[model samples]
Structures are given as structure tokens and as C-alpha cells.
Target chain A: MAKKAVQKAATPARRASDAGRAARIEGGAVVVTGICGRLGRRLARQLHRERPVIGLDRREFVGKPKDIEHHSIDVRRKKARELFRRPDIAALIHLGVMHDPRLGAEEHHTWNVIAFQKLLEYVERYQIPKLVLLSSANVYGPRPDNPQFISEDAPLLGANRFSDIRDLIELDMLAQSFFWRNPGTETVILRPAHILGTVQNAPSNYLRLKVVPTLLGFDPMMQVVHQDDVVRAVRLALRPGVRGIFNIAGPPPVALSRAVKLLGRPTLPIPHAVARAGVERLWRWHMTSFPAPELDFIRYVCMVDDRRAREVLGYGPKFDLGSTLRAVDEERWV
Target chain B: MPARTALARIGDVAADDVLPFMGRLWGGARRSVDELAVRVLGSDFEERARLLQARYAEAGGDPFGLDLETAKYAVMTCAFFHRLWFRAEVRGLENVPQGRVLLIANHSGQIPIDGAMIGTSLFLDLEPPRVIRAMVEKWSQTLPFVSTFFSRVGQVVGVPENARRLLEMGEALLVFPEGTRGISKPFTQRYQLQEFGTGFMRLAIETNTPIVPVAVVGAEEQYVNLGNLKWAARALRMPVFPVIPQVFVPFGQMPLPTKYLIHFGEPLHVQGDADEDDAVMEEKVHLVKQTIQSMINRGLKQRTSLFF
Candidate 1:
């Protein structure tokens, strides 16, 4: 019944906003934000192979892809679309999500939440046909009661657990709203579970640390997708007519202990009860990289069922569990 | 979670025997003790591994993440108590079928020792030893190290999905429908069965699995539940905090020698919709409850003394 109220409230606001503009089909160039990052640069290049793209970010791609026009500006402020070559870009790919834990709540709200709102305002104005938002599966939050394979429809209980998770859930909620409100903009939210590779990580505690500390009693299973697979999923989302939320998890869920071993690192087994308090102290002392609540991830599972992504979007992950585990950079020990 | 499949595929074989011999330090009475333990507890190492392998094959992975070697250690430890401490006598073993079945039993002892004894009976006493995967009480999941310990030992938290999936995979499931009431109810209501829940009946109907009514004798006197420390348990997020007065006294913590009799009834088949009306489901549940109640009565009547 409460959900009914949310739906009823969202529909009218959307329709009221849509009443002002003349109904028209959306088409033109594709605009990719966060184009300087590793994933963004590759995604822009892939999109550019099919059609022309306008790259949006404050910096240039280190090895910029061919024929992709670049625009330099922060999306937080005024009419940033003026820099675009054309008014109507066919799609908007948001990959500029900031993931550093050092950023406090206000900073996260500004860049992750408020700036995303500002981008949607631009998307609403342009009536962009498609929007592919790459979100993290951490939105599920690690919990003991979580099913072995959680589907996309599982509730978002992660927001209140960790301070950093709040922004991710907020961004997802905002995108979901946009998905329902403006049917014209086909918004596809890709919740990719722990993407492991040599280059990048998905807010992982296992990476960067020489000796990973895990709860002695708890060895939660993990579902990891390869970076290459994530690229393929995001590319599939940008295609002509794909929409809705999908869990972009890959095959053969691996336990946290096994995953650490596969990465060629040793682990320090700590008591599950004391681990939280110890991690909190370590976080406060600036000795540890992750926040206090992230200890929950190491203790409990947050794996998702991604068969929907394959069935609906035709996304096929190339790397199996073994290959993906092997792909992680052993030299990445920080 | 994918334990032996990939590792075995790469030819780094998981030892065929669940127990890896600890070199020469394991000599003397230790070797004789292990053999005596296995003989008395009644589990062949090879047979245990074979059972676990079949279970792993059906489940596609170590879904519960049970370590067979550790489970063997646990079984050996439990068998000492089950065989000597309780002197348990099990009956009607052939009534338990090979495929998926729910053993609806009355829980006692203010804890799960009754459940553990029942599980040991199936594992050690049966011809083709069956690992009875018991579902944990929901509150038990909140206990920090305890929950993980339970999972690693192949006991899952009692959620409907966990039960249904395990049943669909043709696993033998153990459920105490009376739940916390059956186990945690004060010692005054000890053998008196509490009102049974109909969830198990609905699940049995849904999966088309047979239901076996079981009665356990002598567990009721284990740890007397004087009263529940509701406030303390609530603050600690525990299900029920039993105020066992016996816990305070030295050697009082141990239960008095109480012989246990486990009687497994015929696998009664119920035909109906899983989502049928509550009245219909409750009526079926009552039938199973009555069967168990009668079994408990007979076991109590046949018991000659407390410490047999």
C-alpha cells in the first residue's frame, strides 16, 4: 500500500513535467560522462564504433579513443550541454561515480547524488532516448539472511548499513524514478557485483591489502564479474532498446577466503565479533582503507542472480570464475 | 562454495578420505581411540565421504559449506555423547525413505541437543548413513560465531526458501515445527507438545515430499528452563534467554543421565495444494502432530527408568 502511494506520487509528477514539452522521438549523438576513467574511455570507444560520441569529463582520456569529441566541464552546475556539438544526444552513459572512502558525507552527496540529479535535469531537457547508469551491487548490503543468489528485485537495505553505500542507493533510487517517470528515456540501471580484474576494483577490501583480514568463522560467498564482462553489459545497455534494472553477476560464486587465495595472498583470520570493533579502530586511526561497515561485506554474502541480464539484454560474460580469479593482478598488492 | 569441483578438475585432488592422517604424532591410543570412536559412533570414513560426494553432486556445490573432515570430527565427538551419555535407542529406521522427506519432530531440552541426537541417529545407525540436514531456528542466526559454525557443519537457518530448495534438490530435511516453543518452553510443559506450525505441512505438499513424524524421549529433562530472560535476550538480539538454574552450580551444568528413545514413524503422504487454505493445512499438520504425540506416549511408556 505504501509502494502504491510512491507510484501514484511519481506518475503525476512525471506526467505534469511531460505536459509542457511536445511529444517527439529521441535520436542523435551519444554522450558519455566520466570519459577519462578506465571504464569510461573504453565504453566511449566501443560506443563510438557504432555511432559518434561526445565525451564529457573535466580531463582528457590518457589514450583518447579515435573520433570521439571531448568536452571539459563538471556536471554539477549550469547549462553544461552548451559545449555539446548537438542539442539532442541519443543516449547518456553515467560512469563518473566517485568511489573514494576519504570523501565525507557532504562531498559524496554533492558528486554522487546532487550532480546525478543535475545530469538528469539535462537528460530531461534533451529527452535522451537511452541512459545507461552503471551502479554497484553493494547496494544489496551484506547480510546473513540474504539468499544465495539475489535477483534485481531484492530490497535495498544497504543504505543505512554503511555511510558510503547511502550515495549509491540514492543514485539508484533517482535512476529508478527517472526510469518510471519518463518512458521516453529508456533508463537501464546495471548493478554489477564485485568486478575483479588487474586494473580496477568495485569497492573491494580484498584488493590493495597485502594481508587481507577475514572473519574466521564467516567465509561468505562472492559473485564477481570481470571488467571485460562489465564492459560488455554496459555496451549492451546502450543498445537501441534495453531498459529496467538487471543484476550483472557472473558464474560460479566464489567464497571470500577462496577468492583471496586465488589472488595469491594470505589472510589473517580474526574473530567475527571482534573484527568489527578492530576495523572501526583501524578506520579511525587511518590504518585501514575501508570504513567500519565494509567489514560486514567480508563477513556476509551479497551475491546476486544475473540470469536476467543474459536472457533480456543478451549479455554473455566471457570469463568464468577461474579465469576471472586468475585475471586479478597479483602485483596489485599495495 | 564450489569446494571440490574445480580443484579436483585441475587434478589437485581433494583427498578421497575426509580425514587426513596427522603424521606420527597421532600414534598411541589416539589411533585406537579413533577406530573405537568410529566403531562405536558407527561411521566408516569411506562411507562418510561417499555420502557427502553424492550430496555435493546433487546440490552442485557445498551449498552449506560443510567441511567433511570437520563434520567427521563433529560426528565422532557427538557420537560419544549420543552412544554413551544418552544410551539412545532408535526405532522404525526403514520408514525413512531415500529421497527428500521432512522429519517433523517435537523438540525438547531448551536447546537443540535433541535435534543433534536425531541427526546422529540417521548418520551412524542407518544402513546407508544419511546426513539429516536440520534447519536452525531464526534467532540462532544472530549468534555471531555460532551461526557460521552451524552453516559450515551443514545446518542451515530455518527459512522457507532454504527448506524448499533443499527439498527440491532431494535432500533429507529435519524440522521442528513447534519451533522455539517446543525447545524453549519451560520444563513444566516438557513432554507436552506445543501447538505445531503448519509451514512444514505446506512445504511438504508444495514439494510433494513425504512427512515422517518423529518422537524423542528423555530430552525434556536436559536443561530445565525456569523462565526466559526476555529483556536480556531482546537486548542481545537472541531468540530466548532460558534461565536454567542448573547453569549456576558446578557439575549442575551437565544434564542428569537421561536415556533417549528416537522413534521414526511411517512416511505419511499428504495430497493437497501447498498454498491451500490454512484450515486445510492445519488439519494435516494436526494429523502429523497426533502421530508424534502417540509415538512420544509409547516411548515414555516403554522407558523402564531415567538412566537406562
Candidate 2:
């Protein structure tokens, strides 16, 4: 509020040329997109105490902290451009990539890709020193022949079976190109494994089901990171000199059955063919959120090797396997 | 209403009393079977299983989904074939070195019973009981129970990365470099070494792992593969379609109980660039292949009978 007040009080000429330059003299604020998300909110709460944080999201940040600045505006809107013009954003952490499979392709594409393109342009123009995009390990699709541990250099093949993941892959590719084209910005792309926490992701929601459905006779090894661990990884990426693609895995890989057992859920195991057709029908009826293609995850190995994240980013998962699996149950009523 | 009440009462009785009674009965039966298995296989089997569990404790049992509990039963089942069915004579048991090593073996038998026998021999015969992790064909991973069974029994997908990771973890890896060609060879081509792939040699050199040439003498006689039906194999999306008349016979689905002789040659240390020219790597691979062939020949010469 004080910063905005000062800008308003300044003369137009002084603010036009010198306002951005002078504000950058102090350590710049970190702009966090999708701050309204559960993971993003957790990250904001952790980061705001140390440095200034500006939240950018279309939705309101409920129970927002006093010090953090919240902007309830669409990322592609002109008002969001006004925030970038301040030139005080030292880093931009993109966590706003929409991945709702139910959303129409046009809206999904516009929000995830087009909005990201606008943000990249701002970062390039403003010369933001750091850019971190929260990509996912799902970009490397589950395959029958995938090596047990996939490295960072693996191709983005998540869209082969599940077309819903196309936007996320596009965003990751866009960030990669941005990293190459703009060398000045320390662009970091984090590809964390299936995150199991209060965050409303597919893995978490699936585990939260009253009777978790699984493919019979298919128990692929899975790696699930905790939400807090992912938040920590994002914070580490925000650190200067930390730049590259890092796969964040929480703990040692466990079988899908083992994970379900850890959650203590009674599972309804269906054969792959029957489950696929059933899920397709249920999805069409809006009775189930899981698309049929997503069943491949439970059927094949899509785990990643987090050696790069551990060696370079110095990030380790503090949550053990048991707690990580149980996190989906936290704050369930909310 | 009277019929509905009677059915609901029967359901309630089944859920409340009959289920628990049945569960207890099943539990008792399973316990007796376990005891019978232990008595038949001897207490040494359980001891070896415990030792293996300790060995894999670091990875919390296994990263590749190797449930030692499931694997021990598999090993126990194979132990029967190794001990009684084929009565495999394992030679040069001490030749296997501790720590990460590659067992380059000849792949034979219409099925992979030879690999299972090798694994069983290593587990039952070798001191400290090393579990051999072999690489299964990637296509097998597409099969339902086969894939799960392979994973539980410590067989991984045949990928370079999986092989490298296994070696790095200081586990013994079994590589049948001949792949489908050697395993599905026609009866006329028996005893002749099929073209070995250079992948195992490259992996051995890259990981600085010692290569142990393993020779199984009697597997070729277990099931006589007349020829490979290429058209059928392609149509079925199978690696190879070996035409074995035994498969058509009433009891011939089971491999003939041919007396087996396995020879483990001394570990060979091959050092070179992993990415060296194929010709250079082939020389090293050829050296290993020739050693295996000679060992197989010697074992064949020493064996007195095919089904003794």
C-alpha cells in the first residue's frame, strides 16, 4: 500500500522513467501466479515473511496475509501488464497452469498457454532475474517400456494417450524455449512426481475417494511428493544460480497397491478394459472426474529420478512415505 | 416380504458368522501348507529368504517392486524343478564374485525355464544366496500377470537404464544377450551359439562390472523347437514363435525332465570405452561368447545321460 501510495503521489514524468528504476533499487518482490491455489497459498505464507510477495490470480486469496499484495485479475488482462510494468518483480513463479480435464479446450489453452506467453514476454521485457515454472513429471508419460528411473532429458510424451495433458506439455516446452532465448533470466522448470497432499490434483483426489478404484493385476511403481516438499523445491529454485529442469521425487518409489494400502482405503479393482469403458461412460455422465486415458498411470511406470534435484537444487523430501501418502486426508472437509 | 426377510437374515448370517469361520479355515489351511512347504524345502529356504530380505532392506525391500515375500515362493517353486524335476548339476559355484557382476548366459528352452533354473541355482547353491535379476523382454511387460509376476520375482524390463541402475545398486544382473534368437533356435541349431548382442558387454564396460560366462548344457534338449513361424510371431506381436510339437502333446506342455548341467566360468574383467566401435566391442563380446561355448561343450562332454 505504501509503495502504491508513493507512486500515486509522484509526478507523471518522475514515475514514467524513474519509478521502475528506483523501485528496483531495493530487493524486488516475488510475483506468484495462481496464489489462490492451496499449494500456492502455502508457498506464499512461507515466502511472504522473508521478502515481499505479490499474488496474481483471477480468484480471491481467502484468508490472505496482511503484508502480501493480492491482485484478483486474470493473468492475460491489461491490469496484469500494469503489475509487470513496475519492474520490481525479481522472480516470477508460474503455478497457474490450468490442467482441469473437464475444461473446454479453448479456455484451457487460452489460460495455460496464452497467459503464460504474456507472462514470458513480461519477464523478458522487464528482465526478471528468475523464472520458475511448476511443470510436472507427467510430461514423461507412463509407458510399458519406460526405464524404472527416468532422467530430466526424457522426452515429453504425456500427451500420447491422454490429450488433456497437452497444455501442460506445451507450457513446459514454452518455458524451455524461454530459458534458452533469454539467458539472463535464471529459468527453472520443476517436474515433481504425483503430488499427494491437500492440493486438489488427480492423485490426491483419487486417493481421497471413499473406495479407490484400481486396475486389477496392475500395480505400477509410483513416486509421490508431498505438497510442502514441492513448496520447498519451488523456494530453492527461486534462489539465484539455481537453474535447470529438476525432477522432484518425495521418497523411494512404492507400488500403486502399496500406496493405496498406506492410505488404508478399500479398493475396488476392475479389469483394465472394463474400467476404461466404465470410466469413459461415467466421465461422459459427469459422474466421475477421471478420464479413461488417465488409467494408464495406474497401469504403467511413470516415475522419475530426482538425482538432479537432490544434487543441484539441494532439495530433499522431508516427508516420509507414510506421511506423504496420508497427506491427502488432511483438511478434507475444506 | 416374508421371502425378503428370510434372504436378508441369511445374508446377515453369512456376513457375521460364516465369513469369519471361512476366513479362519482358510488361514489354518494356508498355515499348514506353509509348514508343509517349509518341511519339504527345508529350513534353509526360509533362512536364505531372510538373508535376501536383509540384502534388499536398504531399498525398503526393492525399488523395482521385488516383494521378497512373493519372490521367495517363486524361488521355492523353482527349487523343486532344480532339485527334483531336472536334477540340475551346478558346476563352478564359487566362480561368481560378490558385489555387482553380470552373468552372461546362453538362453535356451522354448520357455525361459533355463533362466529360472539359473536363478534358483544361484539362490539355493551359492553361499550368502545371491538373487539373480534378469532382464525380461519389453513386450512381456505388456502382458498382465506376466509383467506383475516378473516384477515380483525380480525380473526387470530389458532396458539399458534399468540394467545400469541395478548394477550401480551393487546387485547381480543376469543377461541373456542372445535374446530371442538363441532362446528360439531350431533343434538343428542346438549347441551352436547364436549371435550374442553387444549390449551386455557395453554395459559391463561402462559400469566396470565383471562378466561371468554361464553355460547351461541340457536346456537345448528340454524342448525341441523345430522352427520359428515368423508370420505367426509377427501377427501375434510376439518376439518369436517357436514351433514345438511337444506343446501339442497332452503332457508335453511341460518341459521334458532332461538332466541339466550348468557351468559358471570365472569372472572376466573387460575394460574399454562403453561407446567404443562395435567391431572393438564385438571382439570383447566374442571372447566372452567363445568362453561360454567352450564351457557348454565341456559340460556336455562330461554329462553321462540326458535324463539321468
Question: Which run of 10 residues does model 2 chain B get worst, by summed lDDT?
Answer: B34-43
* Model 1 C-alpha lDDT per residue in residues A59-107, reported as the tens digit of each score: 8666676688887778764547564325556778898888778778789
How much DockQ does model 2 earn? 0.53
Worst 10 residues of 1 chain A by lDDT: A18-27
Model number with the top TM-score:
2
Each candidate structure's count of clashing pairs: 0, 0
Chain A superposition TM-score per model: 0.86, 0.91
Q: In model 2, what lDDT does residue A227 have?
A: 95
- lDDT per residue for candidate 2 within A1-334, as digits (tens), equals 1123233335665444344443442356999999999999999999998889999999999999999999999888889888987856788999998888899778888889999999999889888878999999999998998999899888899998888788889999999888778756768899999998999999999999999898888888899999999999998887755677899999888988888988899999898899999999999999988888999999999989998889879999999999999999987423
State the lDDT of candidate 1 residue by residue for B1-308, as single tens digits: 46677777545333533324333446755889877866676547567657876767565466556656566767776787788888888899999998899998998997689888888888787767777788765555556667667766778766676788788777789999888888898877878999999888989988899999999999998787887888999999877898898878999888766898999999999998988899988899889999999999998898889888
- Computed on C-alpha atoms, the DockQ of candidate 1 is 0.21
> At residue B61, what lDDT does model 1 achieve?
63
